[model samples]
Target: MNTADRVDLVTRYTQEVVTDEELAELLEEDSPSAYIGYAPTGEMHIGHFTTMRKLADFLQAGVDVTVLIADLHAHLDDEKSPFDLLDARSAYYEEAIEGMIEAAGADPDDIDFVRGTEFQLEEEYTLEMYRMAAETTISRTQRAASEVVRESESPNLGGLIYPLMQNLDVKSLDADIAYGGIDQRGIYMLGREILPNHGGESPVCLFAPLLAGLSGGKMSASEESSKVNLTDSPEEVADKINDAYCPMGEAEENGVLEYMEYLVFPILDERGENFVVERPEEYGGDLVYESYDALESDFVNEDLHPADLKGAAGEYVSEGIDPIRERLTEQPELLAEAYPDKYGDE
Candidate 1:
């Protein structure tokens, strides 16, 4: 692909790119690499699936990709993933991510996967950590990680060091681009500022938009009703999508529409298929949409009912996640070990 096409692919559907100039220059290289980190603290959900879908775009543009399973970072973030369960959770995360990539119509073999403990505990990495700590203030560190780490009136020392390790990770991983959700902007911006002093260059940052919750607000991990789990059965997925916040002739804060725009349409497009919303003969039968824009236009004009949109979205969403659910089901022990309290009995 040409430079302009590559740039479009990289920036498409993203919330923001740190600098368009830097991204253009980086894409000019024979082989450019980008990395995104995810701490395996909770079950892989549909929200995470949306972010993973972007990797297909990077691969299509010929950009090499790396996924960082930040096990240590998970523990430091208020001990969300207990130290003893880190290995199990990390294993589950890697498999789930691979499944997501394949479901998005991309080959998982093209990407490299790295674990935090693989190099974070080394002597050289440890020395740099100390140097960064000496140069950074507690207040600065807290500010950088405020949106990411759990907030406490008296934060633990581990929380303070979390951002430092993240900064160092860019250098250690040798990434040309640091990709994540927009909530990570603060920590990455801090890395761009201070990484140079620690012998690393500022990376091109790519941030994805966060999807709204099905229940009507920000998607939260603690609230089961907010997001659909990766392992949810097709019936469960349909029920959740049926109960999602979708209003007739209105699109604002509609999770069902967001899922169609972000997840369903993209996956279907990749597979060379159209989105089909089935209806009875009296309701004008089935409606086929080759693009999300056309579908949204019909809905806004009141030509389509909210019930029809929700029913279609649920089917497509369920279809997209079926492969992931099947893969995880083959290894029940993975989930049982990773989250014994929740999946042990099952």
Candidate 2:
């Protein structure tokens, strides 16, 4: 693809890019590396889907994709995943990511997956970490890490070192573009500043939007009602979406509409399907949306009722998540072990 086409693809579902010029320059290179790292701390939900869908765009745009299962990062930041359970959590994360890639209509084999422990402890990487610590102040490090990590007034030294290591990861991975949700912006900006000091180029950054939870706030894995887990039963999904907070004729902060825009519409567009809002004939019959914009327009115009939108969203999202749910079903122990408190009975 040409630069413009590549730029469109890379920025398709993203909320922001560090610099359009930098991204355009990256596309000119032959298979420039792009990577996103995820700490294995929680169950992968629709929020993860919204972010990971950007990978499909990158792959199609000819950018090399790398997924970092940042197990050590999790341990470093407040020890979110306990030391013993890190392995299980990482395993579950990788499996879930691969399933998401396939569900997004992208070839999972085209992407590279790496665990932090694979090379993070190496002599060279550790040396760089120490170097960064010397130059970066404690306050700056903590500030850079604040949004990406759990904040504590009496924060541990590990949290202080977390942001520095993250900046180094862009260098160690040899990525041309650092990809993640907007919450990682602080860390990536720090990387652009310090990477040159470590013999690495300034990276182009791409950030996807952080999806709102079904309950009208940020999704939390600890709260089952906040978002739909990939392992949720069909009945469970329907119930959650049905009860979700989607105000009539208002798109702002409407999690149901956000799902349709971010997840349902993209999947439908890919599959050559329409967004069908089923309704009885007497109630103006079923409405079909050729695109998300069309659906949103109708929704804003009050042509679509909240109940119908929620019902349609539940069905469409369930279809999109079906394959991943099936894959997880085969390995019940993965979820059962990774999050025993939530899925142990499975």
Candidate 3:
């Protein structure tokens, strides 16, 4: 691919790129690398899958990709993943991420995976953390991590140290691009400002749009109905999609439509398939769409019913995730050990 095509591949489907100029320049090089970190805290869900799908774009553009399984950061963020369970959760996370990468049509072998403990505990990394702590104020650290870490009137010291480690990670990982959800904008922006002082250059940041909850608002981990778990059965997937917040003739804040745009359509395009919305012959038969925009246009024009869209989305999503579900289910011990309280009995 040419420079412009590579740039388009990286920039398309992203909410924002910190600096387009930097991305263009970086693509001119023979190889440029990008890194994204995911703390192994919760069960992998469709929301996580959507973000993982974008990595396929980066890989296709010939960018080197690294995934950080931030196990230590997981515990530091309000102990969401207990220290004892970190190993299990991290293992599960790697497997799930590999599955996500493959499901999104990218080779997992092409990406490098790193664990936080691999370097974060080293002497040099520790000294740098202390130096960053000395240079950064408590309030600044708090603000950078506010959206990501749990909040409290009286937060723990670990929460304060979280963002500092994240800033230092860019340098340690040797990443040219820092890719994550838009919610991570604050932390990455802080990294841009502080990394130079710590002997690291500002990374080209890529932020993906957060998918709205299936029920209508922000996707919440506490609310099972708001998101689809990777392990959810096909019947469960259909039921959740059927109960999703998709309104007829309206596409805004519609999770079903967003799912089709971000997840289903991209995967279909990769497989050289069209999104088929099945309907009875009397209701104008099955509608085939090769692009998400065309489907959205028909929906907004009231030619495509919400029910039809939801039905197709459910099937596509289920089919896409079935391999992952089956793979993880076979290794029941992974989930059981990672989330004992929830999956132990199953």
Candidate 4:
């Protein structure tokens, strides 16, 4: 696919552009294009879907894609200290990646799952990684990656090397673009500078909006209330949505309701006149929006009832996720067995 097509996918997820001219040049170049990936470090959280969907969009556009299962980085970003062996963590990370790939309907065969430690040891990758670490300052790296690092309990040597490894992945993959969450903007910038020094071109960084957790802050696997896992049953999904803290006329602050505005609404808007995905006739929802103004008018006026909105949002989540969830069920034993203490039974 050309740069414009790649840009479209990025816009759909991130709603912004980093570099227009460079993207166009890459598109014009006759070389095949691919996207770089990071490992599924923890439980496959809602935030990961942004990158996954970006990959799907790229695949649909016929771009070559490389997915690196960053087994090494998982240790750095893991919500806890690494075990002495590291094998268990790696195994879990791989399972999460497999489950995620299956859930997304992405072809496992088409992707490359590189363990981060193995990639790090390669002489070429090692040289590139250090080269990036040298060129970028501690301050810049910290600034770009503050969200993850700041939240980390043990920001040690592994954490510092984590960013460099990410930058090198793009160089080693020789990808035309990189996909990540908005949170990874720092790593992408570091890659922009570090990769070029290692004789690789800078890639256009595309990001997706972070989905809100059920409890309202950014969706995190750490907080069960904040997210509905892909493994969640239909009843579980519905219960979470029903319990969603959507105050009337305040969808922005409420995470579950905001998902309807952010993720579901954009997809609905793209459908033009017959956006039944958000406004199913079953709920008296038939949004006729020729422009953003009309849609905003309806939303601000509360023309869309909260129940219909929530129900439609629930329906969208249920329907859109069925295929992926089915893929997840195939590996029941692999899911995170521990639920949040409160909702463990559900």
**Candidate 4 global CA lDDT score:** 0.62
Best by TM-score: 3
Candidate 2 local Cα displacement, residue 286, angstroms: 1.1
TM-score of 3: 0.98
Q: Model 4: which residue pairs collide?
A: 144-186, 214-226
Superior candidate under TM-score, 3 versus 4: 3
lDDT tens digits, residues 210-233, model 2?
A: 777778888666778879888788
How accurate locally is residue 314 in candidate 3, as Cα lDDT from 0 to 100?
93
Cα-based lDDT at residue 172, candidate 4: 73
* Candidate 1 lDDT tens digits, 1-346: 9999999998988999999999999999978999999999999999999999999999999999999999999999999999999999999999999999999889999999999999999999999999999999999999999989998999989999999999899999999999999889999999999999998999999999889999987889988877889999988988998888888888888888889888998888888999998999998999999999999999999988989988888888989999999999999999999999999999
TM-score of each: 0.98, 0.98, 0.98, 0.80
Residue lDDT tens for model 4, 1-346: 5567755654565644567677665556554466655554445654564456556556656667777766667666543424332454455455555555555556656666666666677887787677667777766776667766544454566667777777777777778888766777877887787676678888887766677777776677677777766667777777788777766666576676556545455445544432342556776747544443454456667876666556656776765556657765675544433222333244
- Clashing residue pairs in candidate 3 (N, C-alpha, C atoms within 3 angstroms): none
Q: List candidate 1 segments past 4 Å from native.
A: none
Clashes of 4: 2
